[model samples]
Target chain A: MNLLKEVFMKYGYFPGCSQTGSAKEYDISLRKVIEKLGVSFDEIEDWSCCGATSAHVTNHKLSTALAMRNIMLAEQQGMENIIAPCAACYNRLIMSQFEIANHSGIRKETEELLSASFQKDVKVFNVLELFLNIGIDKIIENRKRELNDLKVACYYGCLLVRPSGLTKFDDAEQPESMEKIAEATGAKTIDWNYKVECCGAAHSIARRDIVVDLSKKILDDAKYHGANVMIVACPMCHTNLDMRQRVMKRTYPEHEDFPVLYITELIGLALGMDEKELGIDLHFIDFNYKDLVPENSGVG
Target chain B: MSVNTLKETNKLLASFVPPASFTDEEQEPLNTSVQLHRHNIADEISERTFQDVSLCYQCGKCSSGCPVRYYMDIAPNKVVRLIQLGFYEEALKSSTPWLCAGCQTCSARCPKEFDLAKFMDAVREIAIEKGIEVKEKNILKFHKAFLDQIKSHGRSYEAGLVAEYKMKTLDLLQDVDSAPGMYLKGKLAILPHNIKDRKGVKSIFKKTSGK
Candidate 1:
């Protein structure tokens, strides 16, 4: 009676923009880890962007319409559930669902804008929710290598459990879902303050300085709490925390290197997947897996 | 004069103080003209976002929880207060909306259940519509560049977005050192992944933009 196996046999995958570019590791590790778990994902064919923060800030209607088109596409392909790996995409999709369901004006306007019938029934899940659906026992049972040496700071960032009215999955302010999932891999999760802190998302390019400053505080907090590595689910958070470390070094001479790994990558490692196969090598900060394994573990 | 009685006397004195006169006569008069014109900013925001800005009681919870509050010219609570006070231009012209980051933390922790994040969105949209000078030009440039990428390709192209943003803001040479490393890691797609429904995407953009 493996409820996990039956729960997510298939889902519509919305990789979002970063999965193909800035966060390819998330896409790769997600696919590899899920495949090992006997789950399959059918990507929505020719899906467009979800509009993210840009459209929402500039034009609310455009944001809803953009996300609605993807939902419509998933429905057209007959998917009951969708897994948006990026937190921003998941937030936008779910926000659109909430808006369309509650506000008839928005629903009518979105339908008219896209010229498509909006059923608005498809369920959107973030990566954390996807794992929760897969069940923690399944992850613990499938672990090929214990991650005892890994001290993880589960950074939820923002958008994962926000605007509680819309997400409704976990506590918006104090999220423990990521910590629970990270601990399932035998990794010790740190109790840190900046788990739900903002990592200066979407300002990675336009305002790198702010991203650097904000990410520095998060990294500093995690390290101060004795975390050797940080685990993140959102690609934007990963970019700011991991990619911006280069600038951190230049700005603050005391800045030390810190590795940021996607939650899927952590699970992939626990499942005995290779670093290269999991795209861990693609990260900006270096991660030495040999040091984490025990001397006589006979693993890897 | 006991301390409590003195405080009450000061409060009475404060109540008698005349309103500050508009230093710049060229500036539109506050409250009086707004009342007569029936163009209340709070009502406009409420109508646009469906959020009752009147419900905000200046608790400052939104401002305190804001991650980027230090960067904002006006605090989140004060922006809502400014709207409540009918100072729409001040709220619109401030850099608060541009620096919000759309995290929804304020809206989440707000005791009044005010959707401050969506309110910020409405402020930014209205600011642009009214042709107000953007306090944070680079942020707007970045957003425009991002939207342009989506409009052309129906998806966000990081390479195209970066190039367009750099050209637009002329903040060239910023993050140049990291570009090579990102490209090497296969994180920067050289070509845009154009979707099949380009017409559909374009139409969505056109109709929403009111073009």
Candidate 2:
């Protein structure tokens, strides 16, 4: 019996803009994976966008206000912890929480504007955070299938661990939280740098050239370390690394079909969940698990 | 730093590619009028965010550790020094701030705890506000397109942003090759998603943008 089955049963969910729009596959796989883990979610109703990289880059006030709306909305729903899947959304929400709680000026200004009291008690967790706490024992116990053959490069991709103050749940320089989570899903983890490197998140839209160059370096490092698949927590990283792998061809000509999967989708596969149920076919890169996940591993 | 780390840094530095106009900046004089302009700009930066650039000492820690430094017009530490010495125009006009991926590598490794990434952001913001012709135009264009999309719809519309960006920049065929694959993978959603408190969102933007 898995201890997490009862211990981690329910959570408040906040799927950011991309979860509904561009990266629907993350939402689908995340839901299925969590359900199999016996975890239920009370999603915040009518949640707005988290004012991601765009808001913070241009207007700090607007960025905090947008995140404040969601925090207040979740508190209204009587939830203390929210499971936001997108890395950009998680970064904004968590950092905003840190700001409002510590700085009285920002807090007072935001509260008056939102017409809701700011509470420092409310906690925001990205899916990676939750998985880090979900322990390897339970993960191993729940595995119905094993990803024995696939060498995965766990890409933390800038948001999961950075800035050294807020959202620094793991080592800011060298994080192993994602590696632990990936290993629990029976995937072989590789040893390579470029874990917390930026994938040119919002720059994916305007400056594909920059993103292509940055992401190519990351992919080349992963490939050099003998990784066939790269696992990422951020949807933006997936969009840049996996979807834009073709664009990176000019830099790395010999690069092959590299699938960038959300950590939740990999967890779902380990739990013997179906591909369609997890929206596996929705990847821009052709990702067939059978090609990577070998049958009769004899280890599982 | 340890011996191994110093050796590693030297190896990385050996492969460093300086920008095209690196020697020109050294040749150009930081005249009295330019110094005054820079001083005023530094005061504005401090007044805006209360982040003191004078506290920064030239350790070169930020520069050595910066991943994108190879592609930068000036080193990250030098940008801080440029601000301290009152060279605001040089720092702003450089491709360094625009190319910053905001990965926080420099911030994480800063000995004096100065945020190099945030400083770059402030520099970029001032550049945009001043209507300075950026070294990286498409980078500026992309940021403008998203803000334009968000001001209209409460959130980013992927298709709308791409279309608007392409139309504005007239780089229609830039990444056109990737669109068909994106649509097929359900990565490109056509409909714009609006939240219920959109008016509230608009008010926030209105106040911030001062429109």
Instruction: Find the candidate with the highest TM-score and give its number.
Output: 1
Q: Scoring model 2 with DockQ, what do you get?
A: 0.42
The candidate 1 chain A region of ten consecutive residues with least summed lDDT is A1-10
Model 2: per-residue Cα lDDT over A206-268, one tens digit each: 777778888888888898899988888888888898778887877668767677888888888
Q: Which stretches of candidate 1 lie over 4 Å from their true place?
A: A1-8, A293-300, B1-24, B28-38
lDDT (CA) for every model shown? 0.88, 0.77
Interface RMSD of each: 0.8, 1.8
Worst 10 residues of 2 chain A by lDDT: A291-300
Q: Give Cα distance to truth, residue A44, candidate 2, Å.
A: 2.1
Model 1: which docking level applies?
medium
TM-score of each: 0.92, 0.87
Predicted candidate 1 versus true structure: per-residue lDDT over B17-114, tens digit per residue: 33344223445653433331234556667778876777788999889988899998999999988776656778888999999999889988888788
Off by over 4 Å in 2: A1-8, A293-300, B1-39, B47-50
